[model samples]
Target: MKAVIRITLKNGVLDPQGKAISHALDALGFKGVEEVRQGKLIEIELNENDETRAKQQITEMCEKLLANTVIENYEFELTPVVSS
Candidate 1:
């Protein structure tokens, strides 16, 4: 089983890094660079099979170690890849 976690800042949070990226893009003449936000993606491999339990555990992991919940929000998806 593989889990992909995406951590992003909640709306109304100030993202200085994203703003810097946007400014750089504008300096490069990229059109329509309306907005940008930075986030973190984490991939984990596990042996768990139960989707519900696995999601719960992973969400706990995110809350504990993966993300700082003070200003960010995180979501995770579990992918089960069958071996042929």
Candidate 2:
């Protein structure tokens, strides 16, 4: 199984990195972008195949270490691994 997690700063939180990216884009001549919000995408491979158990474990991982729950919000999707 694979867990794909998306973590981003909560609304109203300062995002200096995002701001920097926005500035860089403007300098590069990109137009029409009002804002940029930086985020993290984490993919974890799990030996477990059960969806229920995988979700539970991934949730725990996000809450404990994958994200700063106080300032960041996380959402995840679980997909089955395919072998050729």
Candidate 3:
């Protein structure tokens, strides 16, 4: 099974990296670049056969290691792999 997790900052959190990028864009003459935000994607490939178990484990992993639940939000998608 493969799990894809996307982590993003929560709304109302200040994103300094995004702000710096936005400023650079404006300096380079890029117009209409009002806002920018940064996020992370984590893709994990596991050999588990049980899809439900893998999904549960992935969620735990996200909470423990992949994201900070205090200021960030995370979501994951589980995909089953078919072997030939």
Candidate 4:
């Protein structure tokens, strides 16, 4: 099993890095770029075969360590790994 997690800052939170990127884009002549939000993606390969159990475990991982529940939100996608 494979789990992909996307962690992003919640609305109303200050994102200095995002602002910096937006400014850089404008400086590089990337016009019409108003705002930018930065995020992180985490990919995990799991040994569990059961989809239900894998999702549950990944959810726990997010809550425990993967995401900061205070100022960030996370979403995940699960996919089956095909063996060659």
**lDDT string, candidate 2, 1-84, tens digits:** 999999999999999999999999999999998989999999999999999999999999999999999999999999999966
Q: 1-84 in candidate 3: lDDT tens per residue?
A: 988899999999999999999999999999999799989988999899798899889988988999999999999888887787
**Candidate 3 clash pair list:** none
lDDT of every predicted structure (CA atoms): 0.92, 0.97, 0.92, 0.96
How many angstroms is residue 13 displaced in model 2 relative to the true structure, after the best TM-score fit?
0.5
lDDT of 1 at 40: 95
TM-score of each: 0.90, 0.97, 0.90, 0.97
Output the TM-score of candidate 1: 0.90
Tens-digit lDDT track of model 1 for 40-80: 99999878888888888898899899999999999888999
Of the pair 1 and 3, which is ahead by TM-score?
1
Give the clashing pairs for model 1: none
Inter-residue clash pairs, candidate 2 = none
